[model samples]
Target: MSKGGDGKLADAAYRTVLEKILSHELPGGSVIQERKLAEAMGVSRTPMRDALGRLEGEGLLVRLTDRLLSVRVITLQDYLHSLDVRMMIEPQAAGLAVRSLTPNDISMLRSELAALEADESPQLEGRHWRFDDLLHELLAEKSGNPFLSKLIREMRRYTKIFERQTVPPRRKPGLDDHGRILDALATGRAEKARDAMAEHIRNVRKRILDGL
Candidate 1:
């Protein structure tokens, strides 16, 4: 394969492994045998190793005894730690993003909020997470600071992968929180947007701890 093709394959391999982990296809504590996985995935060993190494760096995989590797069983503590980081940065992110947010940005966020409200698939839990992430992603990207945006993206990635939906079909408070955040942004109240975002994150943390 050409150099570019090799790089693409490595990226594809990485995404494949990440999807498996997020979907729990490779459950926590399941061994990650690179050779076997490489053969099964029909990818080169180098790329497979690269993917595994990336996952390990992301705390999704741990190198065990004798070079063994297994998925990291995410704990409530890990969840809260990630949330704690978000609480500190993301609220300020909303405040900063206010200056940069255009009417178009507000409209786009409103549309997402509307879609989230309409989403009622009880069994398709992953759908909710995608929307939830989308809502947060907009704030992170529009927050007017590339580094902060990148940090928020990184912090939220783990939460997205480990998050489980509330079964038995309950309404997500995030839907309303997101709406309120959007409202604050629409009305050009930076501090209100900031506070709303902070409150939303706090409510999320409470839900997670209560679930635990």
Candidate 2:
């Protein structure tokens, strides 16, 4: 059994279940059978229940009637709302990062960008998601506001569904946008960074709408 920071088995089970949900291993809208998940993860019902409750709180799962847990579906409305929130949050974060970013931070970002560029393996798609997460997380950290970083991290959970659903053709354009934002940051041009981030998110919004 997995343990929490307090070394409780329930914490580990919660993390395991959350990983599966976020990685799309569970897929959206699929009914979650607690007993089955507990058995599959080699945990007991109590720990699994604790994990499920946490997942539900994070909007990764929903509890239905009869104590059924289902993966939360990402509706178009949800996607748009998330994009709106990101547009409001990330560009400002980028602007703040421009003022506070260190050489080391830029170097780390450059490394991530190189990895993104060199990723040709089919299995590396997941790495792309992690790269995006890291980029935003870095920006949040550079913003130097713990509360803002926490909020951004929470909002980021909603983005994975859109990323997974819209990867193949849109990925390059997304990377190009990321490059522009990075360039703006490197030059210490806060306005440019903000605009670049907004443009990138707008493009994503358009792509998602185009698909639907």
Candidate 3:
């Protein structure tokens, strides 16, 4: 039982560490010393070691057989692949959402959209990303499939890294795309909603790849 608890602790540690890396707090390719992290996180070396091992498995961290660990750097190919997978998944999820969405779900989405539109300051762009995440979460919930929702949430993490890196310059246009998606969803048009989401995701990929 204690071992199971330790495993859960390690998993939580892995996730927190991965978030720090994605947010650039640790930055890509930064070296990670297990002993240092274990001390910093106030856990025993065993749990910290387990956490690092899990991160390496997830491709968020790379482990050297000799014991060095570093945050994984995002390559252009990685970016493209992530975009492709998101394009394939999220629009289909949106279509599912249309068939399942409740009136209350629609109302909440509208409220989030309104909040996103009202915020225009450069500093508030991070807040916009949070709202964008909420939109995706709501869509996932409306899909009425727990497993799909979990997968979407996991996939969204990669997109979050892309957004933090590329969103500021393209913030206005991104919001416009978001507005269009919300409009389609509001009308309960599944195909339109799916197409709008696909276009929005594609535009983001183009902007990122174009070095905007």
Candidate 4:
């Protein structure tokens, strides 16, 4: 394969491993045997190593004492700190995005959320993450600040790792929060959107803390 083809294979490996991590198929603290994983992925060990190296650099994987790689276990402090950063940034993004988000955008999000709510299959766990990703990412991308959007996306990844591993799936409450946020955004009031996003973040923190 050409150099470009090699890079593409590594990219595919990276995404596949990342999906497994986020979905908890390869839960935090589970060891990653490179040769075994490479075999399972049906790729050469070279691409798998490159993918693992990238994940390690991203803080999603760590090398333990014996030089074994494992998924990074997110600490509570890390989770809270990420949430704090999000609270500071996401509301601003939401406010800024009010004008940018079209009515069609709002309608589409509402429909997706409704579908998620109506879904009760075992696959709902995965769909929950998807919906959450779509909503936050849309707000960030529409916020008109590339820097702010980048920050939100980076912080969200860490927070989600913790949420998926430790926190139970919060379907109804989360959907309710998203609904309020959508309602606020639909009104095209920056303050309303800001307040709604802030409240949603606070509610998430409260729920997590209360359960502890």
What's the TM-score of each model vs. the native?
0.86, 0.86, 0.83, 0.92
Ranking by lDDT: 4, 2, 1, 3
Instruction: Count residue pairs with overlapping backbones in model 1.
Output: 0
Give the worst 10-residue stretch by lDDT in candidate 4.
167-176
**Tens digit of lDDT per residue, candidate 2, span 95-190?**
888989877888888888888888787757677777788888889888888888887887777776745644443443478888887888898988
Per-residue alpha-carbon lDDT of model 1 for 1-212, expressed as tens digits?
45587677788899999888877788777899899889988998988988888889878899897678998877766767888899999999988878888998788767766776777777445666666777687878878789999889877866655564222334655677778888888878889989999988988777766765
Q: Write out the backbone clash pairs for model 4.
A: none
Q: 1-212 in candidate 3: lDDT tens per residue?
A: 35587887797778778778767778667899888888888888888888888878767787755779898777666667777888988898898899878778778877877877787787666677677788888888788888878777766766676556544545544778888888888789899999999999988887776775
In terms of TM-score, how similar is model 1 to the real structure? 0.86
Query: Which residue segments of model 3 deviate by more than 4 Å?
Result: 1-4, 120-123, 145-151, 163-173
The per-prediction tally of clashing pairs is: 0, 0, 0, 0
- Regions more than 4 Å wrong, model 2: 1-8, 165-173
Rank ordering of all candidates by TM-score, starting from the highest: 4, 2, 1, 3
Pick by TM-score: 2 or 3, better one: 2
lDDT of 2 at 134: 84
**What shift in Å separates residue 42 of candidate 2 from its native position after superposition?**
2.7
Compared with the true structure, what per-residue lDDT tens digits does model 4 show for residues 45-155? 899999999999988899985668999888999999999999999999999999899989999999999999999887888898899999999999999999999899888
Query: Where does candidate 1 stray beyond 4 Å?
Result: 1-3, 122-124, 165-173
